[model samples]
Target: MTIRQRLNKQSICILMLILLMMIVTACKSDSENVEQGINDLEADSEQLNPSEEEEGPFIPEGKVQSPFNGKWIPKEAANKRPIALQINNSLAAYPQSGIAQADILYETLAEGNITRLMAVFHVYDSEKIGPIRSARHYFLDMAANHDAVYMHYGGSPQAYSYIQQTKAPNLDGLSWLDGIVCWRDPERRAIPRMLEHSVYTNQKHLEDGWERRELRKELKENFSSGLEFVKEGEEIIPWGQRADYVTVPFSASYTSSFDFDAETKKYVKYQSGNYHLDEEINEPLMFTNLILQRTKIHLIPGDTEGRREVAVIGSGTGYFISSGRAVAIEWQKSNHGTATEYIEKKSGKPIQLNPGKTYIGILPQNLEVSFQKKAINQ
Candidate 1:
């Protein structure tokens, strides 16, 4: 062969080999780039979004909010006024029929040493409520605050007078007295509370009563509860001292205590050394917030039963308990019609409750209220 031909062949071979090497190199580089890119993407994703455990609870969906609890309620229910029910809390009233459904519960002395409850039912549809008792005049103050339709068997002369003066919408069992709005549950295996404790109210009568009375069903204007709230699932309470247990003795025979449960972030209610359970749910009612108010409770001159008259509409001192913490608070009201605003003693801001049901307990000004973080309550 000629020398030139040999040289050309050698050059062609070298060029082909060079091209093949370049192709292989390029392929390897692409593979490495893809692997590096995948690693980078994964690292970025981990940094941006962590596991749910590291994060908090899922944000609640829906815009409709309850002015009562500040939780999401149905749009239909949001504007509706709550039902303020006067519930008996006597020993005969053990295992209250429907109080667990209350958005807010007011525990106060009605008459005697016995404490009574006025449960303002909102966002809950309880089938049967109450061996309903009579209403005390101060209860009207709370009832009017929420614009709730007051429910009771009977009322004191003061209460009846207040009801007439305010022109408040009310449902009285005394008008029907078990004939329509309420009933006597003869099968209730409670202590012989006589025919009195047997009275129970159902939803059917309430619907009927409202339609008959032609009262305002839903709110027309924007209404606020004037409460502050922290984000949900947060255990940190901005105000208040950490307390494991809070006890408020209403009287010698009747004292109620609340034990905070860290697991549920709720307070389990105990009254007279027993857990206050609901008859229907068979569960002790729990509250997210417990308010202890020491106010000027007076004796009504003509009230033969010694029905207590709590001066709830005036400025007073109270303790707001939630999330195992208690804060000193001041409660004030412009009038009986306005909600008693609970102000943080230090911040001067309206007391914000944990995001759930709340219980407000009003004691006589002289009653000793205590809170402790000891191991016995823990």
Candidate 2:
């Protein structure tokens, strides 16, 4: 055979080997581990329910209601300062532990078309919170709404500028003064994840973080979120608008789908083709309240990293979703330090939630968000 033919045969063999390696790399998730997680979610399918909302909205004689979820608790815990943690969202940050405990989550585009999360916790009880990521300035704006002490690792220049200008209460896990609150998981690090993907925060971090930042634990007397809840025995049935399922187009790789079960009266969350679960609680992270807060988004001038600005504050169009339906609503944020208000466009009354865990989607206005009467393939 000619030398050219022999070289051609060798090149074909190399290309075939490379293609096989690519296929294996893409399918390398430990199947046994994934199957076990799916099994656990099935077993723990009963964690969240609308029956949790059965209590009267009226504050009992001595009990205080949480401003976020409207659950009754000691008055002392009622108004605790919220801690907003920035959790990473790359595929490497899989199984974000303890996120289901957050009272509210703010999701928006970070770098690329990908998204990031700022999870606010009033009770401060999540044991494994993150491979905690950097801060986004607009996320800080939401954190400021609750007077939350912002906790993050690193941050973009824009975020740091906002922190400096507002003198916002913040705890940086990467600061020489505060990195003590963050620890690298030995096993995770051993997995040889990118160093950024191995860091996590625990209860100890919470304790020290508060001490280092000199922040208070609870709210002052008479503080309120001004959030309304649906009256007992009432449902948020939209006026003939179907909303049994919604799919958010956050990115080509990452999006979230929620299914409302009439029997349970809770939204079962699915993301990236799996039921999103709290690995710690072994339960699907369900919500009685969900909002799609759509707003104008823009790219910062001359920015190469592709971080964009999200208009979360000020008046905008949005949707309040519950009970297998959605109502068009207007969301207003009066100023930097004030809480966001969701008002019914038709009745002009404040939108009331179902008094259980809530999910808020901070989506770009231009994205093609859609819903269905039936669910996407499970």
Candidate 3:
């Protein structure tokens, strides 16, 4: 217990004190980090709670009824009333009795609330008429087999026209949801006297006819002009002078789903070549590959009153005819003259759609998309 021993003890005490102070500082730093994290979490919570102004897609009070409520159609609900009323009302400039071709389409459409559907029509070549002898294929096969959003079929104008002639089960009389023959009209669009025909069942006639050369160039340059010829409230117009007519049903919706540059490499839904990554990702229900819906709009022959003819436009191909624009979940390779490509449902103004062969998916209502690994958990 001399001076050296005393000095050693003092050094040990100082070392212990230093270690204790270091421990306290570390604890304080960890505590501060935890508190900051808690505060950040609280801020996020406050931001997410919907404000008075925001309203999500909450199912309203009372049991809502539509044709698309459950899985497939319930038996009792079959043979439901004709939806021609819904179709006619939607297309007429203002409701009118002249649109009397109701109750002709189908027997039962599930329920009074049937809102969604997957309609498949046959496409027959113009020359053939018999069902089996018909090309016996589906138009928009690429779309129907997969998603089923588009109002697609595989057949010729002859097939559809033949269907009209035979009065098929639920799809005989001309309604807005049926397929049409894409015929051309010279006076229809202001092209020329001889070159005014469309390419429905007369491809051979068109090619051989003197009008074909001029019309081909015109169609290539202005195939979209047909869309413009259709006035704001113009119902379905007749096909040239024939009793038959070309139709544009309001049953189709078009949209593309592609975003290769995204880090996730998923099919970006709703957003096309236009949305910013941050905006789409941050938005509610934002994801890729979800099916979009569309309404079916049919163009048909117009009733003539002397020189002025009146066409009927109906939209009863009920697919998500719910809160917003109806949902259209598929796109066909051949959508040149379809309604979904040319007009917006809410405004009826023409929208710039993806040209060429592209998958067209649409949700009629203003929709926000979400991703589900499997079917979305209820």
The segments of candidate 1 whose C-alpha lies over 4 angstroms from its true place after superposition are 1-63, 188-193, 231-236, 373-378
- Tens-place lDDT digits, model 1, residues 1-378: 999999999999999999999999999999999999999999999999998867965556655546776676667676787788888888966667888888899998877888888898777768888878888888988887787888889878889999888877888888843457777677773546456677788777777777777778875466655566655555547455667788888888888888888898889988777788889898888998888887898788886878767887888898988878888899888886677788889988788777788898987887877775323321
Candidate 3 per-residue lDDT, tens place, 112-162, comes to 211111222111112311111111112222122221122212333543553
Clashes per candidate, residues 3 or more apart or on different chains? 4, 1, 54
Return whichever of 2 and 3 wins on TM-score: 2
Q: Which sequence of candidate numbers ranks them by lDDT, best first? A: 1, 2, 3
Better of 1 and 2 by TM-score: 1
Per-residue CA lDDT of candidate 2, range 1-378, in tens? 999999999999999999999888767756667888998887676554335565445556666657877666677676668788898877767777888888787677788867787788876577788878988889877887677888888899999999998788888888864457888777777776567877778767876878866777766456556467664445656663788888887988888888888898989887765787777887777888888888888899888888899887788877888888788888889777778888888888888887677888888777776776344554
Q: Which window of 10 residues has the lowest lDDT sum in candidate 1?
A: 369-378
Candidate 3, residue 339: the lDDT equals: 29
- RMSD vs true structure, all candidates: 6.6, 27.1, 22.5
Give per-model TM-scores.
0.81, 0.80, 0.22
As for TM-score, the candidate ahead, 1 or 3, is 1
Error of 2 at 75 (Å): 1.7
lDDT of each: 0.80, 0.78, 0.26
After superposition, candidate 3 runs with Cα above 4 Å error: 57-378
